[model samples]
Target: MKKIGLIVNPIAGMGGSVGLKGTDGGIYKKALKLGAKTVTPKRTKELLSYIKNRNEINLVVAPGKMGEAYVREFNIAFKLIGQVPEETSAEDTRRIIGEMLNGGIELLVFVGGDGTARDVYDAVGSKIPVVAVPSGVKVFSSVFAVSARAAAEIVDAFIEGTNLTEEEVLDIDENAFRDNRLASKLYGYLMVPNVKKLLQAGKEASSMGKSSVDSKGEIARYIVENMDKETLCLLGPGTTLKAITDDMGLPKTLLGVDAVYNNRLVGKDLNEKGILRLLKKYKSKKIIVTPIGGNGFIFGRGSKQFTPEVIRLVGRGNIIIVGAYGKVSKLDCLRVDTGDFEIDKLLSGHIKVIVGKKEEMVMEVRC
Candidate 1:
């Protein structure tokens, strides 16, 4: 049987819903104080449950909440690799992974976001292929699978013998991210099963070229012209959405959710609680969003503040997606992974995206 290693970063995504962009460094403590809950447990369980070839492999997992807690629920046989304290850190992730490698694991399946990906790269490098489950806040790295179910599929493909390819691991600055700036750099690469359809494309920065800028302007103009003055508009992050706020001469949090009413900036850098409060205050509400350039994710990637609760309140009919033609034309389809299977299913299907002035494209939203 193929020996696969599993590692989970227990506190990886605690900061997303609370408006802290990432959980790196000491931000997880802040997330806890703000009532953030553990996100990786559900994600880890989902990945384990979806692996169709569970009987074909022997599992090696980290101790406690890191890995063993979830694997024990499944019928699969697995051994504990390393011990961890109540409060786990990045060092624990890297150290345990090293032990798993030394124990002769054929492949590693890690559940976390970009920070956890970097830890995996540091521990294994190109030594063993991995299936990265997207459970963290800033999962902008290309090394991750599109979703938990997709990660399971990648594992099955690896067991059945698929070619391996190197995917980039992005290093994002959490401090800068919380301050309304996206500072990211290519940190390293990890070898993954070359399941192109199941893997997510890495996040691409917005283009500043003349044509791209003009297209964004066109989209922004159309949205601003059609906006309802009586409706409370919740604007998601990205330059395209920023253009809409720019058109009205209102300030926007470049990487956080904001609220607008009557073309006024009512709220800036709103968290889940803040968003819910605004949703309650305003009767007529709508959400305006732009997909990540390469991954084509309208939610569940960068803007986690638009939690499932917020989305349900806004409803599907009130959501407006906008993208520039230069970017939208290349994407196969849009995607969403809100961590709630029900919400994801509710968002899947065909949707309209405003590409330019009076121009719209019908794109399918895949969960």
Candidate 2:
């Protein structure tokens, strides 16, 4: 029988939406005291639903509360082979993944947000095929399904002899917390179903970069020259691309991505809704963004302004990647991460991003 691994971070995303930021360390203690119920452990129903009908795959579990509870809730018979650490952190998650790899499991399906992804990445190192069911507050990496039901659908596809693909998973800055600082770390990679569209976690992808002084004055000039007063130009976060905000003579929210049109500020630090609001106010919209060096993720870090709905409305053609010529030429391929997997897949194509007018360079971008 084919073996499938199941594990759960019971308190993974409990603090989200409740204004607690994330559940980590003793934060859950504070949450319980704050009159908050531990939210459903991330992605419980979704992974199980995938196995509800099929008898082809046998499930391998971590331990009692760790992995067994989930399999039992699904009424699926599973063999508990590894012990789950009671007072566990992300490292424990990695340990369980390592155990599963040794067991030769066919697939590794996990639940949680970016933290969980990091654990799996650390343990598996891109050799295992994995999928994540969305159960966290902010899913930013391309490692999860859109919903619990969608995850079930993906598992069903796999069981029915569908092909899967190896996809890169990313890590996030746990120490950064809610300080409005985005410092991410790359753990490793994983494989998932071959579906082109999937929802990633609202993770703070732990990617970092050097604080270099890059003069974006020329790129800013180009944007200002090309922008039509009638069209809306959505400016994303990061010090490099934000120069457009200054050239437009509008005060930039250093922490947030904003929108400008007809020489006026329409939105500030916009999320999916805020960007869509700006789009509705002005139908013709253009999105401007820049990728952090060492990590090619285009969206989902500090810039939630260009949300999935907004990107869809504005369309990919209007999206622009602005950076120095040196920054632009360093990439072999452009990465797509809009916090929405389906939309990210929609943008899966190769394109040349021209950073400055005088300095011409070509970079391959995959959506």
Compared with the true structure, model 2 gives a TM-score of: 0.58
Best by lDDT: 1
Estimate TM-scores for all models.
0.98, 0.58
Worst 10 residues of 2 by lDDT: 202-211
Across 228-293, the per-residue lDDT of candidate 1 in tens digits comes to: 999999999999989999999999899999999998999999999999999999999999999999
The residue-by-residue lDDT of candidate 2 on 1-367, one tens digit each, is 5688877777766554233445666776665665444434424754576554447778888786667866776666578877766676777788888888898988777877677777777787667677676544434566676555566677767766667766556555544644445655555657788765544333332222432333476778787888899988888666665678777788766545677879898876555545666677786778888765544557543454455667788887898877765565555555654435688778777755657755545565554
Off by over 4 Å in 1: none
lDDT of 2: 0.64
The TM-score of predicted model 1 comes to 0.98
